[model samples]
Target: MSTIGSEGWTLVHQARQKHYDDRYYGHWLGTRDDGQWIIGRLYPGKSMDDGFRDGEWAYSKRFAGDPSTDNADAALTAYVEMAHNTFVWDRVFDQTVGEAIDLYWAGPEVPDAPKLAAGWAGAESPNPDRVVSSAGCSIAMPLHEAKFLLLHYLRRTELAAKAHLTKGVTVDRHGAVEKVRCATGPIRFEYGYNTYWLT
Candidate 1:
């Protein structure tokens, strides 16, 4: 029995704007094929009037039969998880401290794969209450803040790898970006643009 529609999808869940600071991002759960479900996230539109939008499948899974609510819920969680792990520069302004953070995980040294701790790089220690056993986080912040946050962690000798910052960026917010700044060294930014015109 094919649950998916002719368009190739069946909507199961939709994100509640109340849960996301009233920002209308589309985090939807559905099935593109029978027995296979996915979480699709529509990137926020431009000024709410952008004729077209873009999106991606953040997570997907196949089931023995049709997936249960529990499975759908897990996929929704993955939707949020993917959002927390992706730092879309322009979208950072809508994220809060809780949503924007970095997590440090134990490397191969610990066979059990324990998540050592979670916190942003700006602090001297990981947040005491936010300890996670198997999770990770990602977000964007100013270059100086990133430096202060990662410098100590990078110098740690116990970890199997060195920590480094990605994307040298500094943002200003006064209703909108008032200024644009970059780190002192060589800098690069990856940009992709998508737009559609209404007929």
Candidate 2:
């Protein structure tokens, strides 16, 4: 496990062929598509401060996209900053990542809920240092995030996002994106939350 940024967030990574039975051994965390710099977090809920909970990998929301920069380090910086910025810090962190995750998760702290975007449409924020917010309440992304998500969805075969997308399906004036249609389905502005689709 490598450390990310100046922040205490750990980078949990393993090769595709590498798998361990150990619980803390880690999984395929996320990816930074080089060149296009499509940055995305595979696990939305994973908390940098809490490590892993019970059977959970993450508990936060963030986004993805194409190569925004040619530099790997700069691209990485963008991804981590976005993740740290967009989640409710008080929920998992009463203190900070410098403390222990196990203690944080087992404590008597109240669960901090994610806020709804203005107009009650989508997601709003996280408190670390947000890079960008996308898809209203869905997820946040880096520079090339939009293009990345569009391509990511389009690459799939299950949904015909290219054909079904219509204004009637997207987020209304209130900001809530209910049932929209697309080829790649809903593009996650954040990991677990679906915000935008190809229209």
Candidate 3:
């Protein structure tokens, strides 16, 4: 693995192939200058090492007009600033992060209740660092941010476990509690709990 920075954004590029059953899967994960966690989705024919070499591959379609109208699940869809107790989309798509995520979840495709329930749990949770209560009710940000992070954590952890079972080699395979912070404050993600905290 290698670290690269530019214009305040720090990217950690995985410098090796990430594969399963001899099939290569490629994706990117990094933090923007503002301390928000960002991730790129996997694409066929590209290994994680290839993504490192390509560099900023997700922005390729940035100038293709409007992201909102594009339904394609491109490499980099949207990002959130969990640190600030707020979320920000790349504006690369016309849909909000919540909408995009739901669209993918509520589908004609086979339903995975186990996965769906996890997302729902994230939606119902409050900001761990700050929970404002009013009239026996609590207010919180949209479900997308928490859902996104939790899902990613769950997925990566599963992958790591699978690799371990197979006795395969991998890098950055473990998942655990991670925190991201900025001027706004800090957000803590506890993968073990399958939840997150926003301040």
Best by lDDT: 3
State in Å the error of residue 27, model 3. 2.6
- After TM-score superposition, what is the CA distance of residue 109 in candidate 3 from its true location, in Å? 47
Tens-digit lDDT string for candidate 2 (117-147): 1111123323345323332222533313333
Write model 3 residue lDDT over 34-135, tens digit each, in one string: 324444433334433444334444331121222322222232233332211111223532234434333333222223222221221122223477432211
TM-score (all chains, Cα) for each model: 0.26, 0.17, 0.24
The alpha-carbon RMSD values of the candidates against the true structure, listed in the order shown, are 19.9, 17.9, 18.8
Clashes of each: 1, 27, 5
Better of 1 and 3 by lDDT: 3
**lDDT (10s digit) by residue, model 1, range 34-110:** 34556555445433322123233433443324323334335545655655533222343222211221111110122
Global lDDT of model 3: 0.32
Window of ten residues with lowest summed lDDT in model 1: 190-199
Per-candidate local distance difference test: 0.31, 0.29, 0.32
User: How much is the lDDT of residue 71 in candidate 2?
Assistant: 33
Q: Of the candidates numbered 1 and 2, which has the greater lDDT value? A: 1
